[model samples]
Target: MHSVDHRFVELLPTPLERGVLYISGAHDIVAHLCLCGCGNEVVTPLGPAGWVLRYDGRVSLSPSIGNGALPCKSHYVIQGSRVHWLSKMTEDQHHRAQARDRDAVRGLNPTRLGRAKRLFTSLLRRGRV
Candidate 1:
C-alpha cells in the first residue's frame, strides 16, 4: 500500500471516503478509511489518551492504531501520511502496548492524567485495551 494522502478540513465529511484522510484540528478529529482495505471508517481523535497529530509538512499520527474489532483486525502506524503495517500482536503484547499508550498520554499531560486514566479504563472495560 502507498502512503495515505491527507487534506486538512474545517469539518470531516459525514461518511468518510477511502484512501483519503480528512483532518480537522478545529474538531480535533482525523477521519479516514481503514488502511488495510477493510473499507471501515477510522476516526482518531486528537487529544490526550487518543491520538497525537504531527505535521512536518505532512501529517503523522503517533502510537499507531490497532483495530481489534470485527473481521479486520489490522494493526499499523501512520507516520508522514504513510501506513506501516505491523505483524499481528499477541494478546499479552497488545495489553502491554495499550499500557504504553496510556502512559504516553499521561506523560504528555500530567494535568490530564485523570482523564487519560478514565479513557484507559473505559477501553479496558470494552476489551479494546
Candidate 2:
C-alpha cells in the first residue's frame, strides 16, 4: 500500500498513485460522503474497495486521492459507512461485497435499512443524474 501523508484531503497523488474505494469495505478506502460535511461528523459517501496500486479519478462519482493528497476522516472509506452501493466495480468483487454488506446489515438494526435508504435517497434527490 502506498504510504500517504495523513492530512486534510487535497488534490494530489500517492507515491504509488493507487488506492482502494469501497462501498462497504474491510480495508481503508476513499469515499466522498454523500452528505455534505457538517461540523459534527461526516456521513457515508465514501466507500471501500480492494486495494489497488493505480490511480483513476472519476470526478462525478469517485475522486482518487493521490499519495500526496491528505484525506479527511470523513473521506476514509472504512467502517460505519452505508457503503452497500457503489458507482463502478470489478464484477467478481462487486458480487462479493454486495453479499457481505447484505449479511452484515441483517439484524444489525431494524431501522438501519431505513436510515441507509434515506441517506441514498437524499443524495439522489437532485432530480438530475
Candidate 3:
C-alpha cells in the first residue's frame, strides 16, 4: 500500500520521481514511475479511449493500469492518491485486456481515432507504448 503525490504541470519532467503522479492537462497526459518499484516510467494519455483522471485535492484515475508489456507487468488502480494492487493476470487475461483496449480505440469517432493512433505512435516512438 502506497500513496502518491500529484502535481499538475504543462510538461512532464524527465526522470520522473517515484511516488509522484505528474499530470499535464495541456498535453492531456499523465506520467509516473512504476509503483512496483521497477523503475519503469508509465504514461497514460487522457481521452475517451484512455484513462480518465479526477482530482479534488487528491487524484484518482479510472480503470486500472496494467503494464502487460513491461517486464514487471504491474497492475493496479490509483484512487485518492493511494495505490490499490491487483492480482497478476494470466496470459489469457492479458490478451483479452489488450483486445478490449483495441476495441475501445476502434469505438472512438474517426477524428478521435486518428488522434488516438497518432498519440499511440508518438508513445511508441518514445518506446513507452
Candidate 4:
C-alpha cells in the first residue's frame, strides 16, 4: 500500500487526489482513495448510526474499512494515519460480515433474534425477557 502523510483536509478535491484523507467536520465525512491502488473512492460518513471517528490529534476510525464491492476488493484499517493491511476474507466470512454490517446499518437489534428464541422457552423467566 502507498504511504500517506496523514493529512486531513476540510474539503475534498473535485477529482479526489491520492494519498490524502479528506475530512469535512461540517459534513461529518471522511474520504480517501483506495489504499490498494484500485483508485476507487472510499467514503466514511460520520454519525451515530454510521461511523464514529476518533481524532486525538490524529484520526482513527472505529471499524476497519473493507471494500467488498467489486474489482479490487481490499481491506485495511487506518489508525492515526497509518494503514494496516488485512488478509482477504473467505467467502463465508465475507458473507457473514456483510450481514452483520447490514444489520448494524439498519439499526436492527442483533440480539433480538436470539432473545426471541429463548423467550418462548421455560429457561427464560418472564422478568428476564
Per-residue accuracy of model 4 over 59-85 as CA lDDT, tens digit each: 777677777763676877878868888
| CA RMSD, predictions in order | 4.9, 13.9, 1.6, 12.7
Which pairs of residues collide in candidate 3?
none
Q: What TM-score fits each model?
A: 0.69, 0.33, 0.89, 0.69
TM-score head-to-head 2 vs 3, winner: 3
lDDT tens digits, residue span 97-124, model 2: 4575566557456565566556457435
Model 3: worst 10 consecutive residues (lDDT sum): 120-129
Task: Judging by lDDT, tell me the better candidate of 1 and 2.
Answer: 1
If the candidates were sorted by their lDDT against the true structure, best first, what order would they fall in? 3, 1, 4, 2
**What ordering of candidates by TM-score runs from best to worst?**
3, 1, 4, 2
Q: Which regions of candidate 3 are displaced past 4 Å?
A: none
Clashing pairs in 4: none
lDDT of 1 at 86: 89
- lDDT per residue, candidate 1, 28-115, as tens digits? 6687888888887776767865788999878789878877653577788988878889876556666776787667675675556665
TM-score of 4: 0.69
Top of the candidates by TM-score: 3
Q: For model 4, where is the 10-residue window of minimal lDDT?
A: 120-129
Cα deviation in Å at residue 123, candidate 1? 16
